[model samples]
Target: MNYNIVMGTDNKTLNPLVQQIYQKIYPNIFKGSKDIVTELFLAVSYDINEPPVIDLSQSVQLKKEDFQSYYTSELSEEELFLDVQEEALILNMLSKATFQACFPNINLKLKLKDTSLLNINIKVSAKVNIQTSIEGKQNYLSATILTADLEIKDAEDYKKYIDELKKYILPLLIHVLNKDLLDKIKLPALTFKDVTVSLPIPVVEKSFVTAYSCIGARQPDTYTSLNWPAETVFAGIDSHAIETMAAIPFPLKKEKEFSWKIISGHVLAQVFNPRAFVIQADGSIEGKIDAELLAQLTLKKGFFKISFGPHGKATIKATFKPVVHNGRLLLTVKDLNIPKLDIDFGIAKWAEYLLKPLSFGLSLALNEIFLPLVSAILRQIEIPIMHFPTISFEIKGITFNIDIIEAKTSKLENQLLISGIPSVR
Candidate 1:
């Protein structure tokens, strides 16, 4: 994986101050403890995402007199000065300091080129560096002490440090990336027509049997009274009943070539416990229908119908023209009604919220009060019935051309007869 780090606006401006603070507070932060210095070094190194890759080559030497005399001794008593640079200590604190300040919120972008090689990039700005001098003196001697000095070699090292830091922060980065992508993308819509459906019907049979037996009297002859002798009787009967049914296959065999217009739309019917119907997307209506069947099908011109409810209760009826041509059935419809109750419920509220909030409220109120009444009416209507709601759309007619292939007896006995068509490629 290749990784890159770019500096944010704040880091560039605050870096210098951070350096100065670290230098001045380093000794105090350690509280005169040697182990404190070691810990601080390790902490900074770790903060930069790079654990100590190399062992300390040398111990950090602290010049007590250089820093102590400035804070504890007075130079005003005597005009005293001395060369304190020799006593000034040089510690490898810059690398650690830089790593500590930059590691936490470092922005890293990584890309994988291949399996073998990894590249990393980092950018950082706004670095603050601070230097301070302490004055101390002995009789007739004036001395200036250099307190602290720290530096980061270059941007490349900073980039490297950031790359190392990513090992620990990669999970967070991935999470952020996913959230951002999800917010920007939209799910695609499902649309299509030419739907082939299969249904199953079962056939079963039952039977019963009867038998008879007679008991004979020992002293038959004249005392038998000519009795028929009580007889045990058995009877039998037979009946046929449907048990389980496999799916009935109908390939929508084209009976004739025909052209028809769908006036309304397509409907999808579903049966639940009770029953419910929904209108699916207009785009879902598409099919090559037999023209003769289209004419035979009774659908209001320019309209489509579909109904469904609980218990697999469903009915899809549309009016179009069915034409017979070359012993083939062609059916066509302009509109389609696909029951999409699930989708409609979600979209209804969305539309109300988006387009007309007041109307939405009124619609909700009407539904609550009249929904049950409408449902009762639907249940009472024995014959297949369709309900229509007004919707505005440009009327674009669709035509379906189908070829009738063959007719066959449905596996569901004589109850269902089906014509099969060759599968469309």
Candidate 2:
């Protein structure tokens, strides 16, 4: 009955996911800065795992100093998440650039003899400055590399190469970060894991209503007989309560009854039916009765009445239509048919007259039972979760209404898929 909203990165868990992204971007980084290797005419092979491990730890927290906007106080959590910090973004961008420039044209085999081949190692670190502006709902992110240092191993004059590449590669790196990467960056939505909610059983106590009359009453001559027998005739019953069930064509059983008096006899009719049903997308329910007749009734007056007429068996088929009340979907019994009705005894014929009413009552009761149950189940449920790519930080829950971002659902052979994109604010 309660909701919790949590937003933060699990840095330890995200390490592997982040590594995968680096692996994907590694080849492209080398390709973009390939000139760095071609200029020195040095052929060398490198592994992506080597040197300059990226630090994404800073992306988890938001600092007011990180945003260069005067409206920083006005930003909500969602906006802060969307507006990625400029320093962290720039540092990560420069890391990729430095990585590509330092390790280039890897996997090269050298075949020079006697001349000791100089082995050189390179490591890079940087200082970055950024400016952010918001003009008419458009956010602009740009950065300048204040200083970039390249540490070299086994080479005394490597500083010159470091200074040269700094001028060439830093500008290109910053340009791509602002124009390509950050330009497309968006705030992520929140998502939830599967949630289960318990539902209450849907049913009303014995509340069926019916009317009866004295049809087969034994007549006494004058005032001679004081105990006159009367076979209570149940003319009709309110099936509206049962009609409610036609919407959910599922099989359900309940203790049902109608109370009435016939002349001098008190008649109690107990109706019971057990049915199973399935619901289709178009709001139609199709189901068949498990036993003869939609239900059987026991009529009694101090043990003098009968328990279901003899040979009263029927193959009843039922259908239900769906309706939406408030914010929930509920079912109503639309139609009931007795394609096969078997009346074995003469007394059983009387029960057949009340079959339609009986069916309607059952349907109505079913509808009442399931309407709120279905609604509650849907309201308390949680949808499939979504997270930021690779970093594994969740962005938002799956939603249909299109706002700044929205998610769409697709069904595919026992699977549900939700995909979406965030729109600009």
Candidate 3:
């Protein structure tokens, strides 16, 4: 019996499915990662029986009279018969089928492991066993079989040509097997989306003041005996007042549109007062006089209120300022009023009278006490506060705004530049 076979196998049935699998599997495999096909090839090898034999010295002859009769029209020339070999005919047909199946479009030779023939018409068979895994650790196996019949033309050509086929065919088989395994597994999909964020505006402001107080002074007397015996002796005492005020305006405002949770907040404030007095030999005071008052008299606190509407409208208002009068400086809410809310603090009755004046006065006193000490120490140590005698303030507030503009999905292609400090949670 004469036999010949061509075998082919692909796991994916549909063209679209094959393309999808190719797209998904190609990346992972190309990324230098381990793949099922690579693993399988490393695990097994193809099995072939005894090596095929070819003898070039043998006479090239038609195997049977029927062979000549069958090809009479094709081989009309009698001299051409000498070129024909019985073994070559069978080997060439088998080689062609295997090459076509494995390489598809490429032309290649086949390796024959066995050359013995039992009949004029040769029977050939090809088979492949592949094992691989798609989802889990366990590997699955698949097998294919191909059979065909071919007529031999030359026995010598078959012997020398078949060996060349073995070297190239094995790799092609592995490639086909690998592609099959990849088709069975599912791959992960990657996606990206655009997100919107708001930026916060920072506002900083500053102000300052100066004030004074009174002190008593005494003078010593001198006695002289002499002529008139006036026995002059003089002693006198008097009280006089001096005035000085240091006022600093420190204001801070920050506004942020909220979408996600607030991440971080920080606030800092500093106030400084520097004063000095020079006493002449005549016992007269001439320099800066520093006085202390209630803490509220010099300190001010501010608040921010934000309101959000269902329709996504937002309103933000801030109430804060500083007050300086007659060498006295204070920070009070009296300067702040929300007319729309009908909220008002009379000039004298506001929290300013309670906290602002006291804070201010305390601040002034602190400056009076610390400024001179600091200055004196600095003079001795050669160090300065650098930015002293200035008041600084900071406040942080956060509110959420849920009304986000519906962003178009396809617009995500544009790269987004998010410029802002994200809150720390």
| Best-matching candidate per lDDT | 2
Tens-place lDDT per residue, model 2, 330-364, is: 44456655433343432355655544445445334
Task: Compute the lDDT of residue 62 as modeled in candidate 3.
Answer: 26
Alpha carbon deviation, residue 29, candidate 1 (Å): 36
**Candidate 2 ranges with C-alpha deviation above 4 Å:** 1-4, 33-52, 56-121, 126-149, 154-156, 174-187, 191-425
Error of 2 at 39 (Å): 14
| Candidate 3 RMSD computed on C-alpha atoms after optimal superposition onto the true structure | 38.7
Q: What TM-score does structure 1 among the candidates reach? A: 0.15
Q: lDDT of all the models against the reference?
A: 0.22, 0.31, 0.23
TM-score per candidate: 0.15, 0.28, 0.15
Best by TM-score: 2
Q: How does candidate 3 fare on TM-score?
A: 0.15
lDDT, residue 47, candidate 2: 29
Q: Judged by lDDT relative to the true structure, which candidate is superior, 1 or 3?
A: 3
lDDT of 3 by residue, 118-142 (tens): 1111212222212222223211222
